[model samples]
Target: MNLARGSSDDSGSLLWGLGAIALYALISYGLDYRARARRGSRHPAREALHDLKDREEPQSPRHRIVSRVIMIGGGVLTGLVAYTTSGTLRAVAAGLTAVVAVTAWAYYDHRTETRDSAG
Candidate 1:
């Protein structure tokens, strides 16, 4: 398969898969928002990693279940679409590139926010 272009048949699935990825991101963000509200913390992602002393209580069972479902199901489906569009190697490369780029961006933004708040 061409790296730069997708076949017509694959285009629709790719678009749909992209949409699923976006939805997963939005849902994850929304989960973070709810977690923030529960914890009364502005940076939920940082706090959610551990059971901080100030955390009000454990998240509800429903919230926890929904988070798992969205993460696993959405991720698997998006990955499947990517693999179907291209072969294994290309899909892995694309997925890694995306993950790395997003992680770097998030880290940079987090650092900036911390610096701004400190100063």
Candidate 2:
């Protein structure tokens, strides 16, 4: 299927959409696995950071701003890429990629925070 030209068939578009969602889910799962594995290793810097946070909270306005910008930019990029091609499969895949990336990031973030708080 040529993705350069947008396909107008509803069936094709529906398939593409579903495929994209599935692909995204797979990618997110993969990221979760990697994050889980990596978390097992201890890092001195991370420990130190945790200690510092426990002792005194540091305000990171810049960090918050950067994170928000990245999240918004990433969402825009995903939408653009998903809609760029004409083929249903391609577009769906692109959209799925974006979803999975975001999902993975959230999962990793949650895990890290949970672990940190526990430790």
Candidate 3:
């Protein structure tokens, strides 16, 4: 049995899956915007732009720990999904990539916080 050739038959299924993801993202964004509006954020775009700036205050150690835990949990969930949908190799790659990415993010955040506090 040619696995590659057999997988080609499910090309349409892949497209449908991608389309569903896109639709879900759109709805999520819409709901977030609605919530922001309800909160009296008259200038959502401006608020978003402002949010891109460095935070004036550093996150507490407790918050950082919680964030890291949540991020790792998300990575594990992603790995499980990849394993079930794809294969062992892909799952390992995805899980490792997620861990590396999250580590890099944490490092960067820490560096930024240190720099901001020092200067």
lDDT of 1 by residue, 16-105 (tens): 556546644655455555656786887666665443222433334444444345455645655555545555654565465445444443
By lDDT, rank the candidates, best first.
2, 1, 3
Which 10 consecutive residues of model 1 have the lowest summed lDDT? 50-59
Compared with the true structure, the alpha-carbon lDDT of candidate 2 equals: 0.52
Q: Candidate 3 residues 1-119, lDDT tens each? A: 56743444444445443443343334334443454577799876455344324232465565456645554454544444343354355445545555554555456555655765776
Go through the candidates in order and give each one's C-alpha lDDT. Answer: 0.51, 0.52, 0.49
After superposition on all CA atoms, what RMSD does each candidate show versus the true structure?
11.7, 10.1, 9.9
Provide the TM-score for each candidate, comma-separated. 0.40, 0.40, 0.36
Model 2 root mean square deviation, Cα atoms: 10.1
Instruction: Indicate whether candidate 1 or candidate 2 has the larger lDDT.
Output: 2
